[model samples]
Target: MNEKSGSLIDSLERQGVSRRTFMKYCATLASLMALPPAVGRAFAEALAKATRPSVIWLSFQECTGCTESLTRSHTPTLESLIFDSISLDYHHTLQAAAGTAAEAAREAAMKLNWGKYLLVVDGSVPMKDGGVYSTIAGVSNHDMLMDTVKGAAAVVAVGTCAAFGGLPKAQPNPTGAVAISDLVKDKPVVNVSGCPPIPVVMTGVLAHFLAFGSLPELDKLGRPLAFYGETIHDRCYRRPFYDQGKFAKTFDDEGARQGWCLFELGCKGPVTYNSCATVKWNDGTSFPIESGHGCLGCSEPDFWDAGGFYRALSLPANPLHVAATAVEVGAVVGVGVALANRAGKSAAKAGHETATLADLEK
Candidate 1:
């Protein structure tokens, strides 16, 4: 076999990752994905004999934050997901080649691996004026993406920018920026959406692909369900505080100091989907909520244009009105919380005002 040709386990072994550790990783991933233990063993076996796939990373109309998230953060370390598993053939930020030679390298990798390589795009593609807004080596982002995607086995739209048109496609989009999904209809596109998606989430998606040779189960937005299955609100530790109506009205208040829910302070966690609450950042240090800030809902589409960051989700401010609205609207998903909070604020008036989980089900 050639230098780049080998099973993943063999390379991991050479790189100092033990089989026991690798298997443990597999088991964790399997459980995280809601798969049986047998599937973990199957994954381990599949990766042990599978050939490393070639990956081409393209960047356009974006900050380099997405690149930094994976390369700079060492969690789910490079030895397991990046360096030893996939042959990353082209990455604008990481590769050493420049100018014509760089373009040549991309062309060569595409030609050699034709129809089998993975295509990863991290930024939005500008469509105005034939994509003159953003270019690499004098080639437009639109042109390059279309040309490269022609030969890719599957396309991974990393970060919210590439997945949902992000900031580049915000109101008054000057560049006419568009997401990868808007362009690539023929290929199976997997959207990993986050401002800079959790690093371990990126790792998990890649690992699933390497083991199964197919994209993981996806949500309605084409995001991997393994990672995007629950909203940040679902896993947030402050959920109990929200249920109890113990809200921090401002950045500095008794409730705020007590670590109450940030919902009233404009947290979009209730509607936003991501793994930030669980996976976290900076080596599992903490996320925005953990550090006393509300979620900006950066993972969902058009979060940039969603409105003021400090503007709380639209709901009834008065408990009496909330109760009326809940009855009028049939107590929809979010209305239940307001009704529950009614009991917290006026415990003496009526104990029956508390909206039960069973009431929510009804």
Candidate 2:
């Protein structure tokens, strides 16, 4: 069956997923999202009984890098998440069906799961000349987006293009490109913005939705608070060098070899909010700054149009103080969680029922 409406556990079991593996996957998702350990079991239980979610992924003016990044995730591989947990009925990049067959699959999925399927979009919608700049099966990207979203339970704008109008929306603005949010005014959207957003973060959003039947808490920009709460500078490995006003003047400078801050070289870490610093990439190997490169701030809205690359941004009047406050923000979340835990313990004799940020680290 292309789309399963049966118990999810049975579906997973048929796909060779063990009960223990499913439970562990749920636990990992809980930890990844900074939820209590108990929540993992709850998630497992809920997801087991839940119907496998039908997903319809639309690709417009995109490089397909977002799908590539998602496939490279190691721990929770793309196969385990997409094939086992959800029915990915349509994704031009990954699906074998083509042309008419592909469009038919999408329409069938939408018809079967109307007002229930999760819509995942990964490109900017060009409204220029009535969206003639981009099309899928001769249907304008704008029209397709408008039509598909009407039945989506929730929409996930997976890359900066879909979330913030990425490179397509860059200066000159020839395409009249706009984000999915611009047209998806009625449905709740979860934006995961990056040139290619972190894979774990992408899956985490899907996991949250599957387990809870709702979207996770979002920042003002519609990004998940759990992953996009802190600025890259706050969690960056080279942040200490930034605090000391130490930076690499040029690519070959001693500071560069010493792994000093790259802010002077147009690192947008200080202003960009993402998990690149903390989660790293390629299975936690390293991020851009670790490899002696500056952050391009690909995660932020209008990053491409902000200014040219390799040019230092106008420094904040008290940049160090601001960075210091950013670091303190995590400590505050931990402290608040601790205080709440104490009160809960005192009131109900339940010891450490909630997972604090510190606890989640474990």
Candidate 3:
């Protein structure tokens, strides 16, 4: 049955997926990866006849949000089906096997598909005291990762925890947690990082690998450049507002109601890089900014320590220092403006008065 199920086309047909739908999914993945339209056709052809690679998912210190993000909101969709179609030999959260049987299954799959299987890990591995903080089947996560990565074709760190130590590695970290890269030096490790990474981004990486037999081009942080190449602010709907310096001082203010920039409210969109603004969430309904909340910078490393969410990044940490600096700048600018403007002041005032949302509609 496993051999018969190797063909993705046969499996999809059995699941009642039409060829048209499959092709559409391929096109979507191609676009997500920033590949040309021709590559979409190539992706379809490659995935249709290719044999599914064995995948072993290892979970350590995490909230299970990464799995939830990928599975929820899409019912029998192509993305979910593609994930299901993969030869997932072992996953602690989703696997039916437990105890000795589960461990045996993992071992069998590793040995059978050695040097060709994919190793996916979520959550950080606690390295303190022989990794006592997290263990599976009496084996430390550290040991398991080391053993598994050696035979795997590639390693994908799925989520901020696995990629960058996330919350578990936050200040005063008790577990002495570290990311997967800290341990795996030989293997090519792709970091799909977010508090819970975008579901499509996760699958897009998989699709690219399936079609090309290698991982996509990555950024310096080991993130797929297709998704993490641009700052969220660069693609945000409120980008015009940001350019015009029209900012919302408070959540309930008129500027906010008008959908002005949330920078003053500590939006991390400018500094944070992710596909949130473009791809969005909940079936493209909205993202956090569209839902009237400033970006929490969930995708960036050390976001938890980036300071208070409500405090603007431009402001100094010390209130007195910020006040004094603001006053000084204001006085200097005011004097300069007075000295430079006479008849120009009237023209500037007129221009300012005429400025409206229409001026920055784009």
Candidate 4:
């Protein structure tokens, strides 16, 4: 390990992080990685003793939302503290140097770390016109990426841009944008696919890598299963209203006022996989659905192109819906029949059961 990498771990210790806090971080990391409890202690020991790994963060054709999201993690101050555990050798957005000095720093770090460093990339790479659309220090983003990721220990493609090309690769995709996975085939790439993935998710992945020296288990889409295992609908609070067939027809309807289901208003929660419904945003204060808006399905690939935001998807044929409808109809019909039966019983009890009008006159 290099001096810079060694210093990073030392710095973390100096930052008032006690042995217990380090262990707690490890337990959290293990949970995030879906590892057993035994692994947590091992992770803690490894993180405390091992030298920090070098990390090179690259930016391509992107809006920098991923970086923004990463810096905003408030809990444990994980996002900011991550730098204490890794040698952040190169990040154009965060580095202090500029111009030739910055470029030189990147080259030195890459050369020194060699195959030991981790590479994190945000944004898609444009393949059109010989990749001229985006460049860093006169070097095309494509060449820079290829050169940096050559011997990386692992590559984390942050955000949907780097994972699945994001909106740049959306319909008509004029730039011929391609994801990091499309280019770096040899190295293991973990896709954290969201418009800008949750900050905790980003740091959790890094912590897992640092502790275990390997990528966490991924789902079929190469996403961390711990965070992306269930669809948003399955975890949404409005699911009960959906079951009861109470839906909001418009933004200002009575059902909307009652906080009913937003399925009729085009919620894509049924097919959208993310932790938003559970983890939520802004310190768990609220998610979209809880705020009376339908799910926008931001985590799913090509969510922007999925169709209109207010267009409802056809409900799947299920027995539950049929059963609920039957129960409702039965209650209404039963009330009507009870009223008729009560009227007949009242007349008979008044001595009108056997007497006609002619008998009354006689």
Candidate 5:
């Protein structure tokens, strides 16, 4: 490693991390982001030379679930190495200072790192009744957010609350809770939307930004495409069951015990886009589907108001159309699997027979 890289390595060491471990982390991040091996080296290089960007984390009308999710991210260590690596200037939950002192520290960091720091926000901003629903340090959450975001280089809305108003914005929303995008219009914003976003996804977004000095390209919903590009159904292990029309009708049905598809049980995996099926949780141990539970589509907009969790999705009108039931989907998948297996066998036999013909002719 070069001098700049050496300095970065030293910093990591001071933080109780080894150079080899840091490189391994870069490699893992690169693979998850679908970058080439060379890109991993580049990421390490960037992280080594770049100055730690100041981050200001704001909390509002939320349950602190987003913070809980981030803290629970499954990295190499129990403590969050990624979050600790950054220069977190202000966080109400983590900071040591209290009252006016903490507020002063936030203002100082904002001014000093103006247009160069990052703004991370959780929860929604109440817009009704002149934003009186939530307050911080004698200021409304709306005002504090606006003031903090004005000079930020970029903003990351860290949960469904900050991204899509979450539970606070449910029907007949009394507080008129609004997402970060609804309030901050000038800066580039990245929304990590889930009831509480996956911890890896949260850190991955930060890692990407830290490595590239810019936010990753996002979908229409301001979610990073690397993690939210494909629907959960596209990569689900239970996909075969769905295609075969096999399904679990109830929580304790035969199909449920057999690990059949959960479409009939109100799984929204087909419509929800996330990396849950692939990256999974608790160190890639299992996702909701793998545990025999259907997806709740928590990452999508207005998920809280999306109706019953166990209600089945309506299928097409045609009789030939596959029913949305897991059993039927599994049966259809079984037929497809059988045909594919036969085709493979036939191709192998043809190749073997052709070899004999060629030898005889020679």
Candidate 6:
């Protein structure tokens, strides 16, 4: 099948997708990319004319969890449909052609789209013993990545393994696994670093690329700021509890039952950055914190070695300068209280406005 022969709109229209549906998808993509609302229409027009870009997906020394996260957790939404719009020429896990045929397809796509294709990697590359630990068609993963990325326009590291070495590069480091950025220096690399990034986030990145012909603005970690800009703690619904110093001591405690902060129970939300709290998983059902568990900080680098999961970040310790510590805590708490008071007042005022004049006169 000639996957790259037509524009995305052509493919969608052929697939029975309405123009309105496509426009809505484009708008959603715009919102996900944090682009202004006006850009949504621009995105629609650009994407309609944009040809489906050839994509080469590479997997190395890691589990297929990232792929599962992208495919399994969501209903067949427009985001998943967008995947169909891209000419995903290579993906060992999903491709029908196997072995030599698959390898031939990848080589052909790379040759045809050289310097214009997107190379997406989902696993870390093993660098030990001439990269013998992981190989495809007897070709070392490290060598394949190096050779493949040479002609690529941009490389997207799709999971923690591809972005930060992940569990494979954790303590002991048996495979000597390294992230894509460590090896691919020439191409602009975007890291979507999560144990398995949110499905919409995965598609959003691809959509942004398709609409803008460039990667979205990224943070220091090479992760798109639209998705990884804020800490989970900052976005968590229970964050007010943290500011108020109301925390759950035990999993089944009243505070926990009341949906108070889980910081005392070893939540890593404060340090973790991802769209889980907002974009969520399982079709926007709930995230870990919403399910009453603390964040595992899976999105950050070397999270596997970030101490015990059950150890709280705010553990009390004897401070040499108690006065200084108290002052800092007081300032934070004061700000929290002020914000809470303001929110409460706003809500109360809104409620009062809803009262009818007839009731007021009575």
On TM-score, the leading prediction is: 3
Task: After the best TM-score superposition of candidate 3, give how far the Cα of residue 75 lies from its true spot, in angstroms.
Answer: 2.5
Can you give the lDDT of residue 310 in candidate 1?
61
How high is each candidate's TM-score?
A: 0.85, 0.82, 0.86, 0.80, 0.84, 0.85
RMSD of each: 7.7, 14.1, 8.5, 13.6, 13.2, 11.6
Better of 2 and 6 by TM-score: 6
Where in model 3 is the C-alpha error above 4 Å?
1-5, 317-362
Please rank every candidate by TM-score, starting with the best. Answer: 3, 6, 1, 5, 2, 4
lDDT of each: 0.79, 0.79, 0.81, 0.75, 0.78, 0.81
Which stretches of model 4 miss by more than 4 angstroms? 1-10, 73-76, 315-362
Per-residue error (Å), model 4, residue 134? 1.0
lDDT per residue for candidate 2 within 116-181, as digits (tens), equals 999999999999898999998999998898889889999999899999999899878899999999
Model 1, 1-362: lDDT tens digits are: 66534878777777777878888877776776767888888987876667778999999988989888877744556433544467888998888998888888899999999999999999999999888999998889999999999999999999999999999999799999999999999999999999898776777778788888888999999998978898888899998887776878557778889999887666778778888888778877899999999988888888886655664554433211122322333344345445544444465345644432222322
lDDT, model 4, position 188: 92
Candidate 3 — which pairs collide?
none
* Per-residue alpha-carbon lDDT of candidate 5 for residues 53-103, written as tens digits (9 for 90 to 100): 789999999998888878764455523776776788899988999899999
lDDT of 4 by residue, 1-362 (tens): 44544643466766767667667766876775567888777777776666778899998988988888877655656356765467888898988999999999889998999898889999999999998888899998899999998868889999988988888888788888999999998999999888888776777788777766778788887888888888778898988887786777557769999999876566777777778887777765788999988877766677677655664444222111122332443355334433433554566569667432212211
Candidate 3 Cα lDDT to native: 0.81
Which segments of candidate 5 are over 4 A away from where they belong? 1-8, 73-79, 315-362
Model 1: which ten-residue window has the lowest total lDDT?
Answer: 317-326
Q: Model 6 reaches what TM-score against the true structure?
A: 0.85
